[model samples]
Each structure stands twice: as C-alpha cells, then as structure tokens.
Target chain A: MLDIKNLHVKLEEEDKVILKGVDLKIEPGSVHAIMGPNGSGKSTLSYVLSGRAGYEVTDGSVTLDDVDILDMEPEERAAAGLFLAFQYPVEIPGVGNMTFLRTAVNAQRKARGQDEMSAAEFLKVIREKAKTLQIDADMLKRPVNVGFSGGEKKRNEILQMAMLEPKMCILDETDSGLDVDAMKLVSEGVNALRDAGRSFLVITHYQRLLDHIKPDVVHIMSDGRLIKSGGPELALEVEQNGYADLKADAGAV
Target chain B: MARADLKKEKHEATEARISTLNMPQGGTWASMARNEALSRLRGMGLPARRDEYWKYTRPDTLIQQDAPAAALFDSLEPAVFDSVDRLKIVFVDGVFDAAASDDLSLSGVEIDRLETAAAADIHWAKDVYGRLEARGQTPVARPLAALNSAYATDGILIRVTGKAAKPISLIYTHKSEASDAILHHVIKLEKGAELTVLENGPAASRFNKVMEVEVADGAKFHHIRAQGRDHERRAATHLFTRLGSESLFKSFTLTVNGALTRNEAVIEFSGDNAVAHIAGAAMGDGAFHHDDTVFITHDAVNCESRQVYKKVLRNGAVGVFQGKILVKEGAQKTDGYQISQALLLDDDSQFLAKPELEIYADDVACSHGSTTGAIDQDALYYLRSRGVTKKEATDLLVLSFMAEAVEEIEDESLREEIVTRLTGWLERRSG
Candidate 1:
C-alpha cells in the first residue's frame, strides 16, 4: 500500500542529510514497526510521508497505492487516504474538536464525490466513536487538542484516524509521553481499526507499545538507514539488547 | 489667501457665538448637563491633528461649516421598503417622517420622535437627552458632543415601561440629496424594562450624526447599527449609554460600506452589578476609512464589561480601533476585557489598533489585547489544498475571524442576515 525508494531528505538551511537513501515498502493487511534510537529520522520519515513543508527531498520518490504522493500537498495527501498521527498535535483554539473532525471527514467525502453527513447523523457517528475511545461528549465539544493531556491528545489523533478511515496511517512516536495504561488504550484504539485492506507504520522508541498491537515486520533504523529487517522477534531482541549493537553493525556495514 | 483667512475668521466667530449661548435649562440635571457640555466644548474644540485619538480620523472635513441649529423639517418622500420585514422610521434631512411612521403601538412603551417629546414633556427631554460626561478626565474629549448638543433638532425617543416584552426598532433613515444631515436619538429604558433597538442609516446618503442613550435599573438594552453611506459621504455617530444598577447593555455596530465613518460608543456602568458587551465589525475597501473608538467604565463594584472589535481592510482602505477600559478605585471585582483584531488583505491597506486598560482598583481583573496580521498562510494553503478556490478559502478565514463578534449577536435571523451581507461584500471585493 506504500512505497519509498532511495529517499534522501536534508535540512534546507544547513543541507544536513536526515534520511539517507532509505527504502521501504509495506503491503496491505500488515503492520510495520520502525524502531530506532534518538535522531534516527523516524519522525522525519513520517513528516516526509505526510508531505509537511520545509523538508528538502533531494532524492527519491514516494507512492501511495501506486499514486505518486511527493507532488501532493499535506491536505491533498490526507484526502488521498494517507493519515499522519502527529507526535505533537496542534492546538487550534476556538475550533471545536467535533467541528474540526466533521470538516475533515466531509472534506474527504466531498473529494470522493460522496454525500455530506447531516448534523444528526454526524452526532450519532461521533457519539459511537467517542464511546469506543472513552472520550466524553463534552471533550468533543471543546477546542481541538486545546488543554488536552498528552495521552488525551494521542487518543484524539487516533479518533481522527478512525473517523477518516485512511488506507494508510503513520503513527509517529504515538507512545512517547503516554503512561502504560494510556499506551494500552491508544494501542487498542489503533488495533480496533485494523483491517485486511488497511496498513500502519508504527514508529516508537520503546517496545512496550508493540506488545499491545503486534507488528508483522520490525525494522531497526541506525544512522538514517534501515540497517536490520527481521520478523517480529527482532523487536524483542532490540528490547533486551538495545540499539547500541545495531548502531555498531550499521557503522561496520 | 485673504478670502480664505476671512472665511476662517467668520467661522471662528460663529463658533464662539454658538458656544456662549446657554443650553435650554429647566430641570435639576439640565443645568449641570448644560454646564458640563459648555465646559467640554470650551476645553476642546473640534478634534484636530493635536489630539492623538482623533489623529487618524480628522474631523476637519466634517466641521467644514457649522450645521444649522434645526434640520429641514419639511416632510420627506416615502421610504423604499420592499424586501425587509422591519417597521421603518424614516428621517429626512434629520427630521422624523410622521406620515410614514407606523403606529403599531407596543404595550407599556412610548415610542415618539425626540422633537415631539421635547415639545410635550420638558422634564423627560432634559433628563434623558444630551448627557455626555465621562467619569475621569474624559480621555477622547469629544468636541462633536457640543455640536450635537447645540444643533440636534429631532431624533427618536424610546421609553420602555417596566419589563416590556416587545422590542422597539428605531430605524433612522437619512434621505437627503443636497445638504448635510444630522440626526440625534435619545433612548431611555425605564427601570426593569427590556428593549431591542435597531438603527440603520440610509445606504447611499451624505453627512449624518447621532447621539446619546439612557438606560435605567435592571433594564436590558440591545442596539445594532449599520452604515452603508456613499463613497463620497462622511458620517459621525456618538452613542453614550448610561447604565443603572444590574442593567444589561449590549451593542453591535457594523460598518460594511462607507467613505469615511467614525463611531464612538461610551458605556458607563454607573451602578453595581451592571454588565455590558460591545462588539463591532467593519469592512473597508476602495479607499474607504472606518474608525471605531470605545470607552467602557466600571464605576461600581461587581460590574463587568467586554469589548471586541474586528476589521477587514482591502484595496487602499484604512481601519482603526481605539478601545479603553477604565476601572475606578472602589470598583472591586470588576472584570473588564478588550480585544481588537484586524486583517489587511492588500499591501496598500492599513490597520491601527490601540487597546488600553486603565485600572485604579486593586482587586480588578482587566486585560486588553490587539493583533494585526494578514491571513494565516498555512490555514489558507490547507483550505486551498482541499479543492476550495482561493477566494473561497480567503472568505472562509475572514468569516472565521469575524465569527466571534457575529456570534455575540443573539438575534438568530439578524445574525444570519449580517453574515450573508458580509459574505456578499467579500465576494464583491475579492472579485
């Protein structure tokens, strides 16, 4: 469902390479977990995939379901069934969470030539989603991500992903600031949306979040490149041994 | 040059004579009010370049010549009201149109023109009309106050009895083609009375002026004014609201189309537990200039006041917002807030916002904020990325900036109507 070929990204000001010729491909019905230490370009990959501004893509191409996404804007990529669960969600004051969600959902629907949802129908769908996410109706009425806790913001991101029902979702450090219980809750929310035709790329520093939503493939990133690719047991190995050995191995390679 | 000097000398002489004549005195407060007007006029003549508040909105053009003491009292042509469902009160050259006004008498309320009221009841006229004394040091010393005091001949007099249910709409229409016009309205809400007043000037009229409103204890007053004057015309309006104990005063002023307009609303919370909300929105395009200056005072304890002003400037237009919140020394627990935001759509457009807070009370919560910026580029790009045209995206963001002031309007139909008008203006201006 997603492909990145020889992707190289650099800072616009200093021209320092962040993503160095990284290549990855994910098929439908599978979850890919990219485990790396600090400064390993995990979030950079997510931002590059999401088409955020200010990233200089010196080399390579990205495709979503055989459609080139490097030419698309962030919102255009979103409308094309690509979602990014930001690590630090934006705080939009005076814009209610429900209103923002409805706008995003209806925008995607309108792009796909579907009928818009009425207020009553939207209320019903949002109520059901909030029940599953354990988000109160009052919380949905507040401004988008304003004054929300770290875990609550993560949960809201997942709720948006659920409402959007994107074909591919990249969760960038979704468990960075969450407690153990919140991590489990957010993982469960992501797992509930899993299906045969959907794909996910989970980026994390710790392996505990992977315990809840198991991945089929785990890749260890070192020095801006995927140095190791293995089955799910690779995550357990990294958990016990850490990425120090992987970093040395990548240096030698 | 000699002719010009002689004209200036003549003007100064006339102004001196107008200032010396004592205001009509009858009741107890009449002499005090008259003396205050005279002193204020004496202290400050029509605002010039020296005054900081009136620096941008120069009143020199408005005071080209002294307006006559009495407006043209001849009957006016019938008003054109085809689409709206509102009851119209037409004022031709600043005089009330008795033949065209409706006698749909609302219960427990007296809706009469100001001239008729002044002729009939001197006490009521003296008590309610021309009261414009600021609490401390009259910051923006209005020289026009004296001019309105000396020359306003007719206006709308609205007195709502206790707890009146139906609202009275006073539509002040200016239908003059040849001469400059001045219309003053004095609205009084008796104790515990509730009233909603809508005042709109003619769409394509020339020079016009209006003044003071008086509200009583526990009363609720809503005032909405709109101006759509001709591009060559200029209008000045002063709304002085005096609030009593526990009264609620809400005002919304919208200036969508005008050549040069300056609206000043002074709200004084004279008694305890009074609450006031003042919201304004203005749009200026094609060399139009609009200015709104607001002064809100918390003279009593536990009084609350809020002011929010928003402006949109395009083409070579200019917009100004000068808001001040004053809290007296003994006015404890007074909560006052003011915010002004402006959006400049073009490089030539300009916006100036000065929000000030003067607090003398120790236990008061007061804050003032101002922001001037172009539209958010990220939000604009986000909207445009979603297949929305650039104009549509710009309109949406502009409408969102104005939504706060528009949402404060409680009248649902009126709110929607104003929003529609705003959208249409945005469309026309951008197109």
Candidate 2:
C-alpha cells in the first residue's frame, strides 16, 4: 500500500539532511510501528509523506498504491486517500469543526467523482462517530481545536481520521499528550477502523500505545535511519530496557 | 494655461448659466433658496483636488458648463420600499413629492418637507436647520456641505417627540438625462424620541449630494443608507450626528454599486452615558471606487463608540477607509474601538485603510486597527477541498468578512435584507 525508496529530505536553507537514505514498505492489512528517540526524523517523515510546506525532497520517491505522491500538493495528497494525524493540530478560529470536517470529506468525494454529502447526512454520520470517540456534539460545533483540552483535541483528530477513512494513515506522535484512558480510547478508534485493505504507520516515542493496538512489525529508528526491525516483542524489549543499548548498537553500525 | 486657471474659467462659465439652468420655478421659498444657492455656488466655486476632503474624490466630472442645476425628475422611478409598510417621503431632484407621499397621523411625531415647514414652524427650522453650518467650516472642510446648504431647495424634516416606536423611510431618487445633478437633505430628531431612518438613493442617477442628520438630548437614532448606482454615476453623502445624555446612535452604510462614491459620517457623543455604533460595508467591481471616512468623538464621561468597516474589492476596483476616534479631556471611562479590514479578490484590485485614535482622557480604553490583505489561502483551499467550487469558497470567505459588520445591525429583517443583497452581489461577481 505504501513505498519509500532511498528517500533523502533536507531543510531548504541549511541543506541539513533529515531523512537520510531511508527505505520502507508496508502491505495492506498490516500495522507498522516506527519507534524512535527525539530528533529521529519521525515527524519529518510524516510531513514529507503528507507534502507539507517547506520540506524539500532532495532524493528518491514515494508512492502510495503505485501512484507517485511526492509531486502532489497537500490537498491532492489528502484527496488521494493519504491521511496524516498531526501531532499538533492547527487551531483554526472562527471555523467550526463540523464545517471543516464536512468540507474535507466532500472535497475527497468530489475528487473521486462521487456525489456530495448533504448537511443532514454529514451531521448524522459525524454525530454517531463522535459518540464512539467520546466527543460531544457541542464540541463538534465549536471552532476547530480552539480552546480544546489535550484529550479532546486528540479525540477530535481521531474523529477526523474516521470521517476521512483514508487508504493509508500515518499517526505522528499520536500518543504524546494522551492520558492512560485517552490512549486506550484512541487506540480502540484506530483498531475499529482496521481492515484488510487499509494500512497504518503509527509513530511513537513510548511502547505503551503498542500494547493497545498491536503492530505486526516494529522498527527502531536512530539518527534518521531504521536501526532494527523485529516483531511486537521488540516493543516490549525496548519498553523494559530503554534505547541506551540500541544507541550503542547504532553507534557501532 | 495652467490646469487651475482652466478650471476657474470653466467655473465662471457655469456660474454665468446658473439662472437659465432649467430648474422648476416653484414657490417663494424655493425661488429664494435657489437664488441664494446660485450666489453661494458662484462664491464657493467647485471643489478642487487641492481640498483635503476632496483630494481623493474630485468633482471635475460634475462641473461641466452645460451641467443643468436641476436634475430631470420626469424619468424618476420609485424604489423597492414602495411595498414596505412604513411611511414613505419621496424626494425627486431635491424637491418633495407631496402627491406621492402617504399621509399618516402619528402623535408626537412631525414629518414634513423642510421648505414648507419653515413657514409653519419657523422656530424649529431656525434652531436646527443650519446647526452643522458653523462646525463644517474648519478642520476638515466639506465643500459639499457648503454646496448643499446653498442649493438645497427642499428636504424632509422628521422630529419625534418622546420615545416613539415607528420608523421613517426617506426615499431620494435622482434622474438626470443631460448633465449631473445634486440632492441635499437635513433631518433632526429631538429629545427622548426614538426613530429609525432608511435612505435609499436612485439606482442609475448621475450625481447626488446629501447632508442629513442631527440627534438631540436622550434620543436614539438609527440610520441606514443604501446606495446602488451605475458605473457612470457619482454619489457623495455627509452625515453628522450629535448624541445627548444617555442617548444611543447607530449608523450602517452599504455601498454596493457606483463609479465614484464617498460617504463620510461624523458622530459626537456630547453627553455622559452615550453610545455610538457605526458600521459599513462596500462592494466594488470594475472601476468602481468607494471611500468611507468616519470620525467619532467621545466628549463626555462613560461614553462608548465602535466603528467597523469592511470592503471587498474585485476586478479593477479601489476601496478606502479612514476612521478616527477622539477622546476628549475628562471623558474618563470612555471606550472606543475601531477596525477596518479589506479583501482584495483580483490582482488589479486595491484597498487602503487608515485607522487612528487620539486620546486625552485618562483611564479610557481606546484602540484602532487596520488590515489590508487577500483572502486566507488555507481557508480557501479548505473550503474548496470540501467540494465547494472555487467561486463558492471565495464567496463564503467574503461573506464571512462582511458578516462581522452585518451582525451589528439591530433589526433582524434589515440585517437579512443586507445579507441577501450581499449574496446577490457576490453571485453577480462570480458570474
């Protein structure tokens, strides 16, 4: 479902390589977790995949479902069934959450030559999905992420991912600000959306979230390169014995 | 010859033909006012670009030698207010249409033509007719006021006695077949009276001039002026309002269509516990130019004022906003806020906003801000990504910008009416 070949990205002004000769592939029906320390280019990789502004793709290419997405704009990438759940969702004042969500969903539908959803239909679907995520109807009526609590904002992000139903989902540090209960609820939301034809790349600093949504493959990253690839037991080992041992191994390599 | 000298020569020629300008020869007061207006017109001359207030709005196109003093009233048409339930006073080419107006008997409210009322109620006319004359002389000079004072043959005079509920609609229509034309109006609301006035101008008139209001002690006044005109027509209006103790004054001006338009409103809070709200929106396209200048004075303690102006400029249009709030000494506890924002839709469009606040009183809350920028690209993209077309996205953003001002309107029906008109304007632009 997703492929990145020898991808190298750098900052525009400094020319400092953030993602250096990284390669990854994920087939449909599988969940992959990328565990990394600080400054390991986890967010950078997500931005590069989502085509955010100011990140230059200096080398290699990225393809989603055999379609090259490096040249697409952010909205184009979004319309092409690629979704990125931001670590810090933008706070857009004066724009209601429901309005923004409906616009995003309709935009993707229109891009795929599908009929637009009416306001009533959108309201019904969103209300039902919001209940499962513990988001109140009133919160959905407020401006997007404006004055929202940490847990509520994270839940809102999951609500959006549920509404969009992208083919490939990238969760960038989705577990950073969540409490114990919130982490479980968010993981449940992700697990509910799992299917045979969908794929997910969950990025995190801690292995706690991995306990809820088990991944088929776990990759340890250090200094912008995947240092180790193993099974779900790798996450438990890293959680028990920190990344200090992994650091020594990476240094020797 | 220099341009100034040529302009002076043109003015002299226009003055020579003032008498034979083919205006109707009505009653004694009308003739007298016309004669005095001719002399005043000769003395003051036409407004030049050098004048500070007229710097941006030059009156050269209105000073043609063959320009008739009286606009042709034969082709004048009634407006949409004909179906409304309020009392309608019609003014064609600055003259009252007594036969077309309705005769409603309301206690404590006096509605009559200015020229005719001067004979019956001389004291009232003398007290408030030229009250703004002394103040219009210096600081910011208004040649249009001088011209209107000199040439205004007839206008509508409304006086509400105490706490009245009904509203008054003044309909002024200008119809000109040959050269440009002008119409001036003066209105006064007395102490303790509450009233709403709606001023609707001609849809395709050439040139119209107005100097309209005065508010007395403890009164509340609401003024809404809607101007829609053709690309060749020009319109200018100056509205001056004075609020007394515990009084409230609100004014909303909407200029949707015009070639060249200027609307200036000056509000003075002369007594304590007074409040003023001034809001306006201008929509321009093609070469249409709309300029709005507002000055509000907080003279007494516990007075408050707010001014919000928004403009949407498209095609090759230009929009300008100049707003100032003045806090006088000893006017403590005064709250004055002003904001002016513009949205430029096309590359050829232009917007200039200048917001100023001058404070002398201590312990007063005063602030002013001005912003000129294009629509938010992210917001637009977000809307478009929702399946809304590009035009729909732009229209929604523009509507939201103008909605801030429209929401300030107190009347629900009137607010909805303005929004409908705004949507129509956006639709026309999109098409």
Candidate 3:
C-alpha cells in the first residue's frame, strides 16, 4: 500500500544529507519493520513522509496507494489516510484530549465530505475505543498529553490510530519509552487493528517489540540506505549479533 | 511650546470641556460631589499623549466631547445572561429605559436609580458618589472617571443586606448613532452579604462608565462584564472597589472587538484578611485598540490579591496592559500575584505591557510578570498533523491562551457563556 523510491533528503538549515537514494515498498496488509542504528535516516524518512517542514526533499518520491503525498500539507496527508505515531507525543496544554480527538476525526471527515460525528456519537465510540486501550474518563478529560506517563502517551497514540483508522500507519520508535507490559499492551492494540487493507511500518532500534507484533518483512537501513532485505529471521540475526557487521558488510560505516 | 506651556494649554482645553457639561440639579450632597469632581478634573485635565499612563494608548478619542459615529452591531447570539434568572436593568443610549427593565424589586437588596438618589434630600449614595473616584486620583489621574462622575446622567445605586436571591444583570443596547453616554453606579455590600453583578453592553457610540463597590466585613461580591462587539465603538470604563476585613471580591471582564476600549480598575484592600482577584480576557482584530489599566492596593495584613490579564491580537490590532500591585506599610503577610500575557497572531499586531510592584511591608510576598509570545510552532504542527487545519489549530491555541483568565469566573454557566461567545468571535474572525 506504500511505496518509496530513491528518496534523498537533507537538512534545510544546513547542507547535510540525511537520506541518500533510499527505497522500499510495502504490500497491502503486510507489516514491515525498518531497523537501523542512530543517524541512519529511519526517523527522517518517516518525517518526510508526514510532510514535516525544514527537511528538504532533495530527490525522490513517496506514494500511498499510488497517490502522490509529497505536495500535500501535513493535514492534507493526514486527510489522505497517512498516520505517524510520533516518538514523543507533544504536550498540548489547555486543550482537552477528547476535544482534540473529536476535532481531528471531524476535520478529516469534513475534508473527505463525510457527515461529521455528533457529540453523543463521538462520546459513545470514544468510550468504547478507550475501554480497550485502558484510557479512563479522566484521561480523556485531561489536557492533551499534559502530565501523561510514557505508557499513557503511547496508548493515547494507539487510541488515535484506532479512531482515525488510517490506511497506512508509521510508528516512529513507538516502543522506545514503553515498559514491558506497556509494550505488550501497545502491540496488542496494533495487532488487533491489523486487517487485509491496512499496512504498518514499525520503525525501531530494538527487536523486542517485533516479538509481540511480528513483522512480515524486515529491512536493515544503514547510512541512509536500506541495503539488506529479508524475512522475519533477519531481525533475529541482528538481535543476536547487532548491526556492526551488517554496516561493515554494506560499507556504510 | 515648552512642556509647562503645553501642560497649561491642555488643562485649558479640559476646562473648556468641563465648563460645557450639562450639570444635574440635585440634592446638596450630590451637587457637592459633582462640583468637587469638576474642580479635580479641571486640575488634572484630560489625559495627554505625553502622560506616562497614556503613552501606549492615546486618550484623544476618549477625552473628546463628540463621540464618533458607530453602527450598532446586530449580534446573532443572545445576551450572555439571557438564560439566567436575573433582574434585568436595560439602558438605551445610556438612559435607563424603565419600560424595558424589570421593577427595582429584589429581596435582601435595595436598588434605586442614580437619578432618583440625586433628586432626594437625603440618601445613602451621597456617601459614595465620586468618593472612590476622588480616592483613586492619587499616584495617577483618572480624569475620565472624574469626568464620568461630574456629568454622568444615569446609573444604579445598590445595597445588599443579605445574599441576593437572583443575579442583577445590567444590559446596555445601542439606540443613537453618535451618542456620547456616561453612566455611574454605586454598590454597597453590608457585612456578611453576598451579591453577583453581570453586565453586557454596547453602551453607546462612545461610552464612559464608572462603577464603585464597597464590600463590608465578610461580604462577598462578584462581577462579570462582557464589553460588546460594536466594531466602531469607543469606550472608557472604570471599576473602583474597597474590601473590608474577611471580605471577598472578584471581577472578570471579556472584551471583544471595538475601535477603542480602555478598561481601568482601581481596588483597595482596606481591612485585613480580605481576598480579591481581577482578571480579563480580550480579543482584538484589525482596527481594534484595547487597553487595560489596573491598580490594586494591599493596605491590610493577610490580604491576598491577584491580577491576571490575557489578550489576543491579530492583523494590526493593538493591546496595552498597565498593572501594578502596591503593599502598604504594616501590611505584613500580604500576598499579591500579577500576570499579563499577550498572543500576537501576526507580525503586524502589537502588545505593550508595563507591570509594577511596590511594597513597603517587610513580610509581604508580591510577584508580577508580563509575557508576549507567538503561537508555539511545535504545538501548532502537532495539532495540524492530527488533521486539524492550521486555522482551527490556531483558534484552539488562542482560546487556550485565554482560558486561564476566563476560569477566574466563579459561575459555571457564566464561564461557559463567555467561552461560547469567545468561540463565536474566533470563528467570525477566522472566517
């Protein structure tokens, strides 16, 4: 459902290349994990896809279901069913969590020319979705992510994903700050949403998360290039030995 | 001209205006107060551009004799207190429209029109008429309030002896195109009494209003006002208050767009163990100039006072805040907090703030801060990334910025009313 080809990106403020001629594709319903060391442009690729500013797309293209998303604004891309679960969910003071979610859901719906959800309708569905994520009424009432724990933030992101129901989901280091139980809960939430039409890109540095939400495809991103592609066994090999030899073999050190 | 000559010339100009006032013939006490205010105004004159307090906000429009023309704004929403059970006092073109008002009848309170009090041989309002304005004359010259005192044609004199059964809502509606209106109100809360005052208005094309409140020992007084959305209106309003021992007083103001709006409040903590909070939220779009000048004094021990003001300016709108907290000698254990913040949505908009703290007590705690900032870029991006467009995200952030000040309102329904009105303003502005 998602395709990328020869994507090259650089920092807009400084003349430093981040991604150099990178490429990959994910089939519909398939889950892919992109594992890389620090500064390997894994997060950069996610940000560029999400239309974040200040990252100049030096060259290349990214498409979701054969539709060009490069020219769309971040919100437009979101309206086009692109979702990015941020590594660090931002703290937005003075805006209630439920209000933010309702506004988002309706905003996307409005952009798609669908009928907006009524307050009662929104409350009913949110309560049901939140029940599965273990988010209480108080968590929904509090300001967005303000004073939330790391686990709660990740779960909140999952709740959003479940509510938005985007076609493609990119989790940028979603497991970095989560504890073992939290990771299991999050992975369970993700696993429950897996469907024939949905796709996932789980970007991470560790292999422990993949144990819960097993990936169908694995790619080793080294120095801004995905040099190695394999099956789920490739993640086990990296977990056992690390990426030092892989980077050396790829000549990306 | 030299500065001294310029000051003399400006004073003469003020004298000219004061001499032309249509003084009300009234009781000895009322006449005495008006004459005193006239003399005081003559001495201070109207505020000049060079005056320290008037530097950021020009006083020419406010001090002029003729009010500029303003078309009455037809509001789609009902008045804020329409749903509340209240005693409605309606004013048209600054004149009390008795036909459009409820009878002056409420348990545990006494209400009389200022004109009635002025015509009486003896009345309680004589004691307060222009007294607080005269007291507020020190350290700064509130000549406009004095002028309001000297020439105001209509108002209410209220005395609460016990808890009021219902809120008192004073509403002002526009009638004349170029009406210059002045109104004065005096409120006295007896010991252990409680009262809530709600006011909403586009008083006139140009309106000058003053309200003086005295809270006795253990009394509670709450006030919430919404200045109207008359786009071309000019208004200068003042609230003067004195709190007695163990008394509580709180006031909140919401100012929408107007050509020029100056809201000044002077408060004194006269007795120990009193608490007072004054907060306001204002929104201004293009061609809007809004100013809030507040002076709060802590003269009693163990008294607490807070001043919170927030403003959102966009598209060349101008906002000004000048606030001060003063703790007097022997007022030990006093607590004072002051904060003023502004969110400028565009580069062309401007915010000027001056915050001061003066303390002579050794054991008092007083802190004041002022801040001006643009919308947080990270927060904006995060909201937009969630599918909210840039405009909606900005409106949410702006409303959030003003939420703290709006929270100072103690009534839930009234607070929600203000929030709803604010949302409407943002929608209209963004649209």
Best by lDDT: 3
* lDDT string, candidate 2, A1-253, tens digits: 9999989899877869898878899999899999988898888898889876667888888999999999976777888888888787766655568977887788788878899999999999999999999999889988778899888888888899999888899998898889999999999999999999899999999999999989999998877788888999999889989887987887823
Error of 1 at B408 (Å): 3.6
Worst 10 residues of 2 chain B by lDDT: B68-77
Candidate 2: CAPRI quality band: incorrect
Superposition-based RMSD of candidate 1 using all C-alpha atoms, in angstroms: 5.6
TM, chain A, every candidate: 0.98, 0.97, 0.99
- The CA lDDT at B357 in model 3 is 92
lDDT, candidate 1, B1-431, per-residue tens: 57566556545744765654344433444455456655665555656544587878866656666432222222232222223455567665666677877774667777766555555425565666665433323756776666666555556766788655544555555445444555666677888888777766542244446556677889998876666544555777788888999999989877876667888888888899998999988888876888888888888999989898899888888998888988888999999988899988879898887788888999998888898889887566544433344566577778778877877777877776677667667776644
TM-score of each: 0.84, 0.80, 0.97
Ranking by lDDT: 3, 1, 2
Residue B425 displacement in candidate 1 (angstroms): 4.8
Q: Score the docking of each candidate (DockQ).
A: 0.15, 0.22, 0.72
Indicate whether candidate 1 or candidate 2 has the larger lDDT: 1
| Candidate 1 clashing pairs, residues 3+ apart or interchain | none
Give the clashing pairs for model 3: none
Model 3 alpha-carbon drift over 4 Å, by segment: B1-3
